[model samples]
Target: MRSLTGPTVETIIGVVVRLLADERGESEADVRDELAEGGWELPIDSLRLVEILVQLEQELGVEVPADVESARSMRSVRAFAEVVLAACTTSDGSPSS
Candidate 1:
């Protein structure tokens, strides 16, 4: 697997969070705090997290497993990216590192 880039991950998380915040008329800080409250290291709400994951999977052409429930898979932005990247690498016939 390719090394994770902090900026890339941060950018993705920020975009998703911002979108969710805007849609819900909530402050970004509140969203971040909610994720923290949920014990997520990267900090994001569950619905927004699922939306971001679905978007990422579509954009990246990655096939994330459907078996993992929404709560488990969308725990944090970092975890979401990790799972997507890993699933992409394996599902697209790329050699896994």
Candidate 2:
């Protein structure tokens, strides 16, 4: 499900893993392996999540919505990457024609 005009999920996930690793002082490979196993909860709090999203927006040049669903999606790295991918594809968070 690669977006035609947006960052791929893998790219977003890589960025996320890097950010999480930097925040937690862990290696990117370690963080990525944990996420790859599934059912892994992020150790970050809401504030740190917001900071990551901000960094993502800057790095990816996409505006991530600050909303309930987005907040909920931050529970996992994959989920958050999906949200960021979605944001990259849409101007107002809706499907583009």
Candidate 3:
């Protein structure tokens, strides 16, 4: 396993921004700004969200749960990050910093 340090909210947001930009064919700056203004509700469709989650799982090496709770977490970027961070912490047996 990788020596995983828990990912920060900013890191998760950065990844999400990049993924959204790539998926939507937009610039990262535009996506970032939109997400900043939108806050809790992500601007993408469920399909895009799933694609991003798959990418996040690949990039971060964490298995994001596919249950209802996980779906609820996807309501916001920070919430989603918390879920990923929790997974990382669980896998590495380390407290999230």
**lDDT by residue (tens digit), candidate 2, 1-97:** 2234456788888888898899889999998788767675666788998898888887887888888878888997878888888888785465533
Give per-residue lDDT, candidate 1, residue 42.
49
Clashes within 3 Å, all models in order: 1, 0, 0
* Candidates 1 and 3 compared by lDDT, better number: 3
lDDT for each candidate structure: 0.61, 0.79, 0.81
**Model 3 segments beyond 4 Å from truth?**
1-4
What stretches of model 2 exceed 4 Å from their correct place? 1-5, 92-97
lDDT of 3 by residue, 61-85 (tens): 8887777878998989888888887
Candidate 1 lDDT over residue span 38-85, tens digit each: 775545456665676676666556667876653465656666656665
Worst 10 residues of 3 by lDDT: 1-10
Which of candidates 2 and 3 reaches a greater TM-score?
A: 3
- For all predictions, the C-alpha RMSD in Å is 5.5, 4.3, 2.2
What's each prediction's TM-score? 0.50, 0.79, 0.86
Off by over 4 Å in 1: 1-45, 69-71
Cα deviation of 63, candidate 1, in Å: 2.2
Model number with the top TM-score: 3
Give the Cα error of residue 86 in candidate 2, in Å: 1.0
Lowest-scoring 10 consecutive residues by lDDT in candidate 2?
A: 1-10
